[model samples]
Target: VAQHRANVRLWWTRSSLKEHTAGLSNANIPLFFPKLECIDNANQSHLHRLEAVVAAKCVRPGASLRSIGAADVRGLCGGWLYFRQRGGSPAGATFCKEGTCRMGCTSSAEERAALARSKQIEKNLKEDGIQAAKDIKLLLLGAGESGKSTIVKQMKIIHESGFTPEDHKQYRPVVYSNTIQSLVAILRSMPNLGISYGNNEREIDGKMVFDVIQRMEDTEPFSEELLAAMKRLWTDSGVQECFGRSNEYQLNDSAKYFLDDLDRLGAKDYQPTEQDILRTRVKTTGIVEVHFSFKNLNFKLFDVGGQRSERKKWIHCFEDVTAIIFCVAMSEYDQVLHEDETTNRMQESLKLFDSICNNKWFTDTSIILFLNKKDLFEDKIRKSPLTICFPEYAGAQEYGEAAAYIQAQFEAKNKSTTKEIYCHMTCATDTHNIQFVFDAVTDVIIANNLRNCGLY
Candidate 1:
């Protein structure tokens, strides 16, 4: 007979099925009982006795679990069974409960043994997933028009298609992202995080660990919104934040976009709109390959262009790179210098170099001065002499003449420099030449090992 009562108050007195069940086989009647952690066919003393057990969790219909029968169910049965948070809010949690069940069961009060097999299987899967990551050191740097995306594509396709010599289409990849989310995510993960307290805004210690989250449950009561936000921050890597800005950071993407770009433009003349953001296409893409092996180390980097107003942003990237790559765009002085606008751009790059060389990140960083678009220049003008048109030298003014002119400009400002900067030319399309830049970076890394050199 089936008994149903909300106030029945079924308290499971532990019993063994073999001893209590007698000849009561499940064939006569399949009894539905309250949450049961363990079942024994040995006794049938008390009908539906509960020592401890997890609740019956619903599996997706036609899922792999359907193939699991009574044996698998018994094998998996445990007082600490768990559910996955693939989606939705598991409002609270529970560990043990006093509930009722039907049919023959054992009695007495003894803490049940936990399931070891299933737990071990889950542990193994996690370890394997972490080990699968490719542990390669990389330096990603490029401008929007530069063939950086192409290079990344070539590397990926070559590994996939096994290096085809007959025909190779130039590769291209489009990358873009927002900022605020990236900052909050990394910051939230830190221990002993500082939080504003009350109206006084006194800083307070407020830090939570992930393990505490994994141990939470639905019935126990917890903040669904907080949990969801935490999970989302860990899952996504497109959000960005600028460290170059003041202590406060923007959380909105559009707001951040306008601020960062506006700050870069230094435009006091006119205000920008959402339409500006919609039409915003990066004039240049900056890629810096930063590799790490700290569990989940997904990076969301921001492109800080070498434009004069934007030069300062590069300082932010310094504290976050495996290696720093300096892009020197190749353009004929007479051609690219056609307008005053372009002259300012060239000047901006020079100023940036000066800033970078003196920054603290400079001494420890592996540097590569990538003079891209070398194909446009005469192949014979491999090494820049003291004289030559800035980027062109076919009947172009000598490097020294241009250098002297540049030097004279500095002298006029009472800031003449003596040391010459070594600049390497590279046609971004040429992999062999690019590899040299890569090796140069490696050599520097060996000279100064900085794998765990975190923020100051």
Candidate 2:
């Protein structure tokens, strides 16, 4: 008898839900809508009406609750429970009596949690912005094309999230310009070097090639035909003779790689890869600041042009500088300055280093020397002896020995008793090499800062 009573009660509840949902055919009706009317039944008491409403919420097959979402179910149960606790209605009417159910419906907890997290993130970002404004400053000083800009770029790659595809696209034209400039420089300098093709009859061809290159401007975009002409000229005997004596001219380090890929670079839709961007040379005339954070410390790196003409601007940027990274092109020993062909490039770097080291203003500053372009130096040392440039000293043909000898030459210039020069061999184009050097540099700067503060 008890089981039969329970079955009958459940049937009545499901039947009521079906009728409320318009016979279950209108199941798409929003769950919050007033599906249950509170018109007093002729034979049912207030308690029975409330009980039927509660029983309708049960998860039975015929119950319309199956069509509603879980959130709506929660709202329904919460609203019914709240209504029941308030003693329901006196006219045998309960929840949703005259209007839509509004109780138990509130903002989602997930949304509220997300809002809180957003606020905290905003606060942290504000704090970080303030910190970045007052970051430690470091200046990169080196002669033109000595890889100072490359080191700055490597810093961005290591700590500033690296180059994107967009950066690659932007650098395509710059790489092409670098390639053209190098070929032009080689062509222009061939006559001065007393190099030529085998016979006197072909001298007119060399003159034509030189005039074509001289007329072409680095600022202008290269035409495909011009690119093909350059490729053809690159293989010509006269151009080959100039290339063989490349160390005599101020050619870019990237000239060889780009010259070899003239066909690809000449393509209308050429895109520069990351390595090409790294090797691409664009002389920095003004100070370019790159900001990045590492080890909870913010850093502002300044890359300025290394030419003698740009050195006057260096004095203005010395304020609050944490450290100085002086880059020396190790392979430049055999080359001369682009500005004055009479001055040896390595000698220029040494003289500049001497002046900077002796400057009383930088006496307290930590000096880190980057003997840059190790790859080119290694290759150059094997082909041409280092003794040719520094005839006073005798050294082995080995790369390490030559690099070490050159490193010592720069270190010997430090006049400050307090400032010990730290040195590292670097190939700025290589990210892994730069990362390792920068990691050590960070430690060196931090330790020096602590020592100055008497906190070490």
Candidate 3:
């Protein structure tokens, strides 16, 4: 009976030790000392023998079995657990006497220290998430080839580290392709416009230009022969006259610039300049993001393709936008849509702006109107009439008066009374103009975000 009673006491003691130690092990703290193997080896068939073994192996010397508590056993085994929790290894743990055992007891200090570090990391992550949420997200939306991509390039030149030599090299082919394509477009449109080459002798030169455009791949550099032929055709007065009526046909805005600079551009070791890169026309197909920091605030600018086919992909980027920069090629007032020639380009832009400015997705979003291509607009207004786009326009064809009338036409598209349209005249190709305009636009974005946050 006494042996049975002792067995009961031993079992109870082992149970107590397991209950206390389970928590420490579950916490991943390594229990390295006072090995539990001693208990595992105890002879279970004889209750008295098991009790004797536990008392001799687990308890401190001269300590009675009844007097030793679970805590004492834990103190001997959990010292390493405490050490590890404090970022110390068992090999590095200093053995110290505690109350009744040579092994150390768990200290609340280590757990508190670990917990504090974890909390600090979590706090930092939360702060970063909040700051990211606070970043100004500007969505660039406009008609196709309205220089939305040019504005993005200007941002790179001004805010971020400007393009590298490798970047200039990469754009070389694009510049060359643009130059070739522009001339080809002009040559193709000449017959439709009933305009012949100024030099009848150079008609073969025009044919050579066409044949090269058809056979030559985009990656191929322009051969000297083809470059010579293009130069001859570009210099023809009749071809120049056809180019003057470029608005009647779908011509790239940079065609004239590149065609005039064929000599330097066609050189063997030619590298594209900053101006060349800005003027290069590569259609934006999907959403492209440009990240930069300005005035201690982070910005995420999104440039989505503006073509009718590419507009469907834009909804994926509509969420969480801070502002919308709706661009319009004011110079395209006399032009028609490349997609649908019957529809006027400026009219298409206005229709697009009206939809975006009043869309349910952007109801609360700030809308900033960019009257882009001011330089081109000023030049075109001298020859073409604003009445091409807006039939009601009775104003003079001067830059200032004509630009205001165009701006009013866009401003009239806003149906919302609460939402205000902030408009600016921008020349996307000019870095100085874009830099100045973006600075002001940044201020407006910051103010709008602040107001949205109820900071004002």
For all the candidates, what are their Cα RMSDs to the real structure? 28.0, 22.5, 18.0
Candidate 3's displacement at residue 238, Å, is 1.3
Which regions of candidate 1 are displaced past 4 Å?
Answer: 1-314, 337-345, 379-423, 450-456
Q: Tens digits of per-residue lDDT for model 1 on 298-392?
A: 32223343243464565554553544455544433222221342343335445555566445644444444555555533422333332333334
**lDDT (Cα, tens digit) per residue for candidate 2, span 34-61:** 3333233442443242333333333122
* Segments of candidate 2 deviating more than 4 angstroms: 1-134, 198-224, 306-317
Which is better, 2 or 3, measured by TM-score? 3
Specify the highest-TM-score model's number: 3
- Model 3 misplaced regions, further than 4 Å: 1-134, 306-317
- Best candidate, lDDT-wise? 3
Residue pairs with clashing backbones, model 3: none
Candidate 3 CA-lDDT value: 0.72
TM-score of each: 0.31, 0.66, 0.71
The C-alpha lDDT values of all candidates are 0.34, 0.67, 0.72
lDDT of 1: 0.34
